[model samples]
Target chain A: MDSCQPDEKLDLAGVPCPQNSARTLIKLEGMDSGAMLEVIIDDGEPVKNVPPSVEEEGHRVVEKVRTGDRWKILIRRREE
Target chain B: MGIYLDNAATTRVDPAVASEVERVRRSAEGNASSIHQHGVNAAKHIEKARNIIAGSINAEAEEIVFTSGGTESNNTVLKGVVSLSSNEKKHIVISAIEHPSIIETARWLEEAGISVTYVSVDRDGFVSASDVEKALTAETVLVSIMHANNETGTIEPIKDIGRACTERGVLFHADACQSYTKIPLDVKEQNVDFITLNAHKIHGPKGVGALYVRKGVKIAPLLHGGEQEATLRSGTYNTEGIAGFGKAVEIAHTDDVKKMTELRDWFSKELSENIEGVLLNGPDTQRLSNIINLRIRSVDGNRLAAELDRRAISVGRGSSCSSSKSTPSHVLLALGMDSKEAEESIRISLNKWTRKKELGIVVKNMIEIVTELRMV
Candidate 1:
């Protein structure tokens, strides 16, 4: 394991989609293989959407935690 | 397909219109400005489109000036009409619940030192024709109002207001962007000097619209290049989109509108009956048949829309153009809604394709969602 800490963290609590998902995708694109990225997104749609969409891009969602109205998700980039 | 209830924002392109646009874009050739055979053919297509668009509204082809879309058409009319007037007559009047295109343009005109009178609307979102008559003066150069508001879908008394303006010797312009093709409009009967029309709202292609400038109404050009569109609007013609617009207009008949009205009434009645504390936002009569702006007591508009989307129901809450802004809808506020009611507002616009079963699904999902949200 390289580190427990995320290589990048995106706070998208109030950001809209396509924008929020786009930002998270951009961050994942810059990271290395198996690198962990933390994303904080709004509840409901974001929580349901971003993870599946990222996984569709071949990444892995390692963890997701609900904190109040927001969601904190940890994703690992796919190996190139 | 996801149950698309946001037809007011923009509609799905009709299949025939799409095919026509593709066929023209692929087969139709040459610049309309060219004098050669190809150019002549293209120009013929454009003129045919102009005639079709004009004929629908009972206006002459000379009165139609094609532009990018409703927004450009609106800006061109407002700025062009006001620009050519004498400096002493820089006053204009518009309703308070106008689309952002008119309202923001009026705000900019005020910044340029022109006087703008925003007339009030009733609780039902109808603008009083007499109020418009009272607001006019010798210094008032123009009266700009919407034929139907985008949010509330409130149909204004355009004939009354237009007649009043004509009697007062002031020009009347209506942004018919939301009502075009959905309703019948006669420029001559209404005495309107200018009216904006768009294709996309009627299942036509985007980036193409027209402005009806009445004969003998002298206005400055909004664009100056290539002298296209009779020197009023300039730029290479969007031949394909315009053709699609004409095709969409041709295929759009009054019969489809009846089906839409039925679906809208059924949906609204079902929603009202099933959902408690549901309040409507506009007048029941004299409103566009497709749109329904209703409010729930405890649900947040944005959150409700998002939840609906997750459930495969695409609806709009307030103006989609300005949804990012945290402020409540200006149109809702103008209708005497408190901030909370405004925040709770959701607009569900139906189209010809919307079905009875779809409306049932929407009502069931909406009732469940609102209840779930309020509990949260």
Candidate 2:
């Protein structure tokens, strides 16, 4: 499951809270349904918040991995 | 990863100090004003902390008044001094680069019929002694200047200003929140009538601070209540927080200040050499050893802060106390930086706990991120 490749790489690493979520949503809006987006983040609070919020917006969290202090979260767009 | 470079804003409470605070909070349950053994014990803690803080700053323990923090300390001093005078000596002089607490307090005094002269800083963010000398007037009752700037970390010429104030028979007050831990401060050497120190800035608990009022200065009380804090500031004492603050101060004084200075210098040198368009904001030698303000051209400060946050490198822009606002730093502007450059500036402050490896990581990540951002 962890070996699956992402359709698109979205490095949100180094971005602060709220802005990261907002940017991710904007990116997802531009993609087709079922298109995968890999988001890398270092802020701990946003890692917990962004995945659930993105999933609620009809996206699927394909992977969530804690690599050291950063999190690699892959989300697939499901619908509009 | 997750390097905390924003020590100027606030610091992580030292574990020992935190445990001390917790111990007081958990086991010592007594009001200092209560007439019981527990109260006496609490009062003893407060008194001991006061003595430690006072001794560190060369002030008598009785002259130290506890307050909520630096802002309250500044407000108390500004309002207290102004209210005590009804004569023609109603003029107050402050630097253009003082914290908002001092700036707003001065404005409030202006509204109350007091005259205010904002002394300007040089291009290096230093308030010259000559500028301060020129600003002093016959009616100038008090001269309030920050010992160190919160944004640029530029140390002011408080000793010269203090001497001038003494010669002119006017009072001198310094807000030393940013400089208290990083530099050696003695009230006698600085010749300051009042000095403010905050705990959170020195790895201590928040909501607690001390103001050093020289023994003979006559200033009205900001708060009216029971005769606490020598009747200068009126409120129940924050015994636990105060004790924590004292412990923090003791640690800061005894800790290797020179070693921290060397580390900060190395960080600054590394960042300047490795990063492009990284402009140092204040006087190279006159600024505090722990703080380095850098301007990364072509990137907005908000964006840079966000990017750094993503990299797990914590830094700040302008003042941490004023972080919510997106305004260009007023201190940078006072030092002749344009709004664009000011908006691109970020401050990185380091403490003793900061590791060299962490700073190396920060520099590498900062270079990569800034390069990536500039390309975009």
Summing lDDT over every window of 10 consecutive residues in candidate 1 chain A, give the lowest-scoring window: A14-23
How would you encode candidate 2's per-residue C-alpha lDDT over A30-60 as one tens digit per residue?
7887788888887577686668667666788
Docking class of 2: incorrect
Q: lDDT for every model?
A: 0.86, 0.83
Residue-level lDDT of model 1, residues B1-376, one tens digit each, is: 6799999999999999999999889876888666444554565567667778999989977689999999998888778878999857589999999989889999999999889999999999999999999999878998999999998899999999999999999999999988988888999788899999999999999999999999789988889998887688889989899989999999998888888888888888998899888888898888898999988888898899999999999988798787879999999999998889899998999888888998899899999998898889
lDDT, candidate 2, B18-125, per-residue tens:
998998888668776554445545765676677689888888766788899999999989999888876665899999999999999999989988999999989888
**Backbone Cα, N, C clashes tallied per candidate:** 0, 3
Per-residue CA lDDT of model 1 for A23-66, tens digit only, reads 56657877998899999999986787678767877888888899
Q: Please give each candidate's TM-score.
A: 0.82, 0.80
Categorize the docking of model 1: incorrect
